[model samples]
Target: MTVSLYVPLASPVHRAPAGLKLGLLAALAVALFVVDRPEVVGAALVVVVAVGLLVARLPARSLWAQVRPVWPWLVLLLLFHGVFTDWRTGAVTTLRLLALVVAAAVVTSSTRVTELVAVVEWLARPLAVFGVRPARVGLVIAMTLRFIPLIAERAHRIREAQAARGAARMRWGILVPLLIQVLRLATTLGEALDARGADAPVTPPRRRAGASTS
Candidate 1:
């Protein structure tokens, strides 16, 4: 069964606009990086956790699922900083990453995929003047998001199959089949998109007589 990142809830966070959540996430990311204080970053992390649990009313597991994958990377980052730079920098950097990841989890868990795509299309509308189709941009972003879980599912299946085949070291063994399947899936999607005319160029609207190019 495919699981979506979004958790259905009747909370205010779920009801909030997707664009607003995205904007706040962006701002949080910037703020986390700009402020180098570990305590401040730790506080931000606590706030994000509170918002996810209290405000968003998301289940703990939902947020944990999104963050669990990055624990190894965070540990490595901390160790790297401790060895090369000061432990303070490493701790602050790790906290920044953890805070960002949790904040993003809260946003994604509260927002729907369609809502995110709509926000993306709206944000990309101004790029129409540069021959960019907002719909296409939105489609790309939507597909990318969808593909992440699909790819993970495929990799899991590959690993299971390899294990069943008595393969002790399945790491390298799974890669070939996984890559082949991903390529096939990409080719099929590309053909489908081509048949649907997704690659067609959009014609620019004619400008008014008094319209300024600038």
Candidate 2:
């Protein structure tokens, strides 16, 4: 049942409206780019950490697991900035990236995929005049979000199997098989969608502009 990173914790963050959380994330991202000061970035990170620990009430281990996959990328970014640019800039950028990723993890951890899809659909409704079907867009976003964790799990399993076979250094070896598996999964999903009458679409219920705070 726990297909994604969502933790069923009863907290204010979990009860807060997803739309507002998303908006806050967006605002923080903009601030990160526009504000160049390390002090500001540090302050933002303090807030992020506070929310993650005190507000979300997530266990330290669970929070670490949620952000573990991105550590390499974060390190790479830090190293690149530190080498080519200045150490202060590198540190600030690293903090910015970490804050952004953690904010997203917090949102996804609290919100359900279906609720996120609905929120996205509500936002995308105006694009209907541009010939985009809101329902289809929502479905696409929902499936993409859902499959992300699934693919990550698959990749982990493949890596473990390769390690067990003494092919620990064969990182690239996982690529071809992973791609093929992803394609097969996509095909299966498409078939299942068709069977569910996705093509014979009816009007989707209009999503409320305001998200549920409960």
Candidate 3:
């Protein structure tokens, strides 16, 4: 279906280590949450924009499209914050949130689910002593990331179909069908997973695993 929104490509960012990018994201999130200074937030916003442009290679137009959906709600929050708090504070917080969102979008757009899953498993491997199954966790994460965009695309298609079929507005008539279609897709995905033995219990890797591969 020509899914280009967040699919991984052979870009520079894709070549970077996923764990490092995740660490950067975590640091940025912590900074956003703890810092109350507007100047600091603004600086962080600049860093996010610069990184997205240079490292992530996100063009201005695509950046705009990524943030376009959340913009209206951001405006509403800006108004509320300004009235409830102060214009300057509201503006700063709103801008900080936007920067965080953009950073997240850039990371997801650049990183592949396979890379993300591998990172997850590698990170969690040491915790196996506590009975954690990193491979299973990685598989769950992979499936979630993989299907989320697919579900979104299907929903978009359903919405477009309803509109074409003379849906006046987003009434229950349109929403009910969309929900049903989403559920159907989810069921199909679940069935496919079952068929693939994805829900099976995870066992420890066999000793001499290279023997099988060889």
| lDDT top scorer | 1
User: What local lDDT does model 1 show for residue 11?
Assistant: 94
Q: What is the C-alpha lDDT profile of model 1 across 93-183, one tens digit per residue?
A: 9999999999999999999888988997999999999988998898888788778888998999888888888985856888889998888
lDDT of each: 0.91, 0.83, 0.78
Q: What is the C-alpha lDDT profile of model 2 across 60-126, one tens digit per residue?
A: 6777787898899889988998999978888888888888878777888877667777888989999
Each model's TM-score, in the order given?
0.67, 0.65, 0.61
Task: Name the lDDT value of residue 128 in candidate 2.
Answer: 93
Model 1 misplaced regions, further than 4 Å: 139-214
Instruction: Identify the superior model by TM-score, candidate 1 or candidate 2.
Output: 1
Residue 35, model 3, lDDT: 86
Give lDDT tens digits, candidate 3, residues 1-214. Answer: 3245564456677678889889999898988988878888888889888877887776767777888899987898899989998988787879888989888878877787667778879989999999888877887776676777777777688778878988858655656766777777776876687678876775554467353421
